[model samples]
Target: MNHRSDLETDGEPDFDNVNRSESECLVGWDDDNDPLKPSNWSNARKVKNIAPLVYCSFLTPLGSTMFAPAIEQVTKSFDSTNSLLSSFSVSVWILGYFVGPLFLAPLSEMHGRFPVYMVCNALFVVFNVATAVAPSLPALIVFRFLAGMFGGCPLVVGAGTLGDLIKPLNRGKVIALWSISVILGPIIGPIAGGYMGETVGWRWICWTLSIAAGFGAVVAFIFQEETYPLILLQRKAARLRKETGDSSLRAAAKPERNAAQIFARSIIRPLRLLFLSPIVSLLSLYQGVMYGYLYLLFTTFPTVFRNRYGFSAGSIGLVYIGLGVGSGISVPIVGFVMDHTAKSVIRKGRELNPEHRLIPLLPVCFCMPIGLFWYGWAAEAKTHWVVPILGTVFVGMGINTLIMCAMTYLIDAHPLYEASAAAAGAATRSLIGAVLPLAGTSMYEALGLGWGNSLLGFLALIMCPLPWFFYKYGGRIRTNPQFQLKL
Candidate 1:
């Protein structure tokens, strides 16, 4: 008899509910207080597990855009002017992110995160080397994509590992910080990437990326622990069997499924959640647009500031610091606001719904367009460069707020299925991030900085209603069988 409920997390069947036929001793944690359990680890130990994971998360997204600052040099080196391919070079790394996890994430569950982290870092180094030494443009593009395909483990697996250690009550601050790392990579990469590409050659970008990944691999090798409960339990069971000479010692009477089945489910579940569930579809599309908008701005910043403001390729990334500053400042403020608001909601004795997470979005969503319109017109008029950069601070604030709101709401709503929901949303966001930036240069060329961004401002404006509408009706929509996705 299994007592599994849709509300339960971890997806492990309830071993306690079933009567054991096995006379052989079953293996579990030594007890609920077991020291070996990741959740039971001390704070310092959990940080040991998280530090390398966060570094990789930061590094991979950094890789996506580090190449952006040098796109022109890459094109020149190849002696090609195919405009689409140039932008594709930068965005295709993100495309690799979208494809990698469908299979690799499940594999991580099978092999554990330490192995995945080490293997991905090794492979990333291999392909980054290949990218640096590429003989042709096509070869360059293919190598970068392959690096990304293996390199996305950090994005897909990091949060799950955090969950393994930190319960939901204490997760917000750490997660917010970790989440910043993912966004930080893009913002931080250009500052280094632009200057390096200017001083050295564009190939140096790949060389630097390879070296950075190798460093992260060393950190993971030294510190990362196996955090997956099932895998740890399986290891314990195998150990117990060897010592006790009891072949029937088992982790759970039955595991979820074999590796193949788990892989198939991992690949299929996010797609199903994304397309079949309306709540997922809306929030994912909303988050996807926000992610795409950020990447588009990143890809075009060099062109926009360089052509209009007479910035050099090296110095153009400085404008991106406006975004970095904004997000950095927004993190603590958003964290405080979210924490305070949740406490207030609890005081009222009202039923908590995932929609409660949307409360912050009411004031936060409008900030983006304000930044867009302000920055666009200011830059278009050639006002002091400071004016446009200041406008981006507001845009940065909005982007961080919106992403956190959507992600938190999805996690709260899905409970046991949060990983699937996040994967669905992340895949959509990465897909859009990859495709949207390809349009950035052309959109600016046709409309000029002011109208092109004003167009985006309008898009942002239309999306502002999402949080409000969902806050009121999201619970009902989520519970409606018509909107629910079944495995």
Candidate 2:
């Protein structure tokens, strides 16, 4: 009972019949096998397109923490010894992360992904260059903020692009691979920044990022293309209308929304959903705390190692090896574990549920508090340097695993609204990442490293029950009418 045309069913264009007296507009994929559909693209082509985009995403976190090892040098250069201001140089970029997604993510949905990729990324590079040559601390922070705003484009849009190209069944592996950029950026930033700041100068941190981002922009310009289905359909409709003089030509199911409406909704939808959805609220809170803690470490790690162990800048960066290696190794392992877990559940004659995807997060939840406690006490006791680094290893593995699980759960929960859901999560995390680190040094000063980290561990303990609660009650919450009652 296929009511669609032969050409449509067979995944071919019906150009021959387009000039007929009557014709229905073509829209969506011609069929599941349509060559132009992103999901149907060759695996090689998908990798080619996504590689540069993912590389560009690395720039955001790279820029976020690249200043960490240089904080002391930066203060000296400006003759301003304020620790708070130095921290601002690092955290203000997060301000842009918070604001960029609100407008940029929606804009990509409306105009298409390529333009955003090109323009915003170019701006990111420009500001990065400006950051390198800044005359004062104020100028440097301002440039950093601008760079972060534009740097956020890829973080916001890249997820949507991957969602477009990859089917849910196959996404876990790619998501895991793709997430390496997120984990490596900050972990490696301080390492590179430490060497450059100690040997060369802190200004080189910004200059180096500028060069890398500039190169990334060139790659994007060459390979990036419009991937949004609606935009593609609209183009097809316009071409058909022009060629056939058919004023009635239109895309199937394309809305008549104007730019303003699209823009407004793009900015508001995530905010609304974030506040209204209990599922989103809890997940955001969990992610926000973890992300904030990550940035706090970026600020505090150098201080701890330098004061306690008397490590040089370059040497202090080496301590990040524990976290970096843990995250790097865990991503692929977690991906296999998640996919295998999902398949195992399906084999038991049970329909797959999103809640099933949450199994990976359970072990991670327990690990977080344990890692924190171990890290705090070991460092407090002035145990061997390896002790605290070992603690960070556990922390890193737990965090990366938790993030993947939460992301997979959210995407599974709202397949159709993946972008909006992700935006909400990113906004919450970015805000925390932006604001929490400002207090990090002050907290360390007041409570010292031991009690300061202990407090964070306590918070992790309170939040540890989240994954279990979600695993058991997620289905009920999802099925509730309130799930649909959007703000």
Candidate 3:
């Protein structure tokens, strides 16, 4: 282990000396001296560190899509028009997520991670309970949106939490585990929701999610610790000053700002970056379109299977299993390939930068277009149901890989402002989710399933080369002043 004193000798208090007196000065300590650094944490502690974040990921997705199985019940009880209204129940929550991150991500930076997580999750749990018994469609929508606003915290903050607990070099494995929730949540939600809706009706969807979220909140309260470095340092400075009775001990501390100013800056910074940075804007748009397409497909699946193929609700729900399986398979394979590719490049006397991490996306880009075309056409032609299922499998593989690579690139490109970058991505994606479901029924009706899907596939083909083009040229583009490269 590298020692702190070797890095600096400014006569600041020795924070690395575990045996140092409580009265020692605390401010202006080097990060190398901070034993609380995620890299220095024990293995058991690290597991504890990541567990809540995974739960955070799981909780949000559960809230986002768990109601899919209950969509019919919700629509019928509320006298809804068709799957469109039911789709609204599912997609509207995601819409709230798009809006929440703009401000919430910044709030976490100012207030610390734990408080924001707990408060938001608590709000989610409460509103989720309200959604269970909502007597009217508008009430359901309102409650669901509130729940989503709270649920959105985990998606935005979880990555920052990971950064807090893990170093960049060791992050791949941890990120892979986090990816499981991202991929599996949508699949699992419908599976469980389908069964519960069949047995207990749609009201149980919200009730069940509320129960699960309540449990997760309890676990989080007990296990999750504050991980923001600045907040931790501030705490250390306060403790040392109190112990030593030295007014001048705080050398690195800055005057505290009011909440209004903090909130203003936190809310505005992402918007500023969104307008100023071409890379962020383009990437956000790309991710938004992809996410919109996913929700659109989700809305279409039930109609295709239930009306055309004549599958039972239970069986239709089982179709999502193919997506879950495909995503699960991709996670480990992608992780291994990413590691292998990086090592291979290094062995050839070339250092792999963040842009190099995007190489896997090239294959995914082609896979997505092909998979979309296969699924759309197979479903339209009413070919063997197996063919469409296989197409879904390919779609899953492509989506998982694209998400993994895109997110990795975002993090690598903006290590200092990852939360903001991720927020921007989430905002665009959520907006699409909110709007796409509303259009799915109309689109399919106007164009018919075969042509509607074919059109999507065609669009994917048009964008297929984007990842490769960026991988080859992103470094040069990032070097431009607008991208905000940390180095």
Clashes in each model (backbone N, CA, C under 3 Å)? 0, 0, 0
Per-residue lDDT of candidate 1, residues 1-487 (tens digit): 3323222355333333213454744556665567867777999999998999888888888888888888888899999897788888888888998898888788777777778878888898899999999998888989989888888888878877887888657886787778878878988888888898889978998999999898988889899889877677778788878997878877754345787877888888888989888888998998888888888888878777887888877887688998888788777777787778888878998767788888878888999999999989999999988899999999898988888888889989987788888889889988998899889888888999899999999999999998999998898898998876776
For model 2, residues 20-82, the per-residue Cα lDDT tens digits are 225554544556677877777889888888999889988788888878888888988999977
Worst 10 residues of 2 by lDDT: 1-10
TM-score of each: 0.94, 0.90, 0.88
Which residue runs does candidate 2 get wrong by more than 4 Å?
A: 1-32, 41-44, 167-170, 245-247
For candidate 3, write residues 1-487 as lDDT tens digits: 2224211122222344232335544354455636765556777887876787788788787667667656666777877876666788788988888778867776886778999999987998899999988989989989999898888787788877877777767876787678677667888887777777778887877888889889888888888888766577667767877987765554243335667866675666666656667667776777777777777777667768877788766666776776777677778777887889989999999977888767777777676667778887888888878788788777778777777777778767876666566666768778977887788778888988778878878887887877877888888888876566331
Q: What is the C-alpha RMSD of each candidate to the true structure, in Å?
A: 2.4, 4.0, 4.6
Instruction: Give candidate 1 misplaced runs (Cα > 4 Å).
Output: 1-19, 23-25, 167-169, 253-256
Output the number of the lDDT-best candidate. 1
TM-score ranking, high to low: 1, 2, 3
For candidate 3, which ten residues in a row score worst on lDDT?
5-14
Candidate 3 positional error at 104, Å: 2.2
lDDT values of the candidates?
0.83, 0.80, 0.74
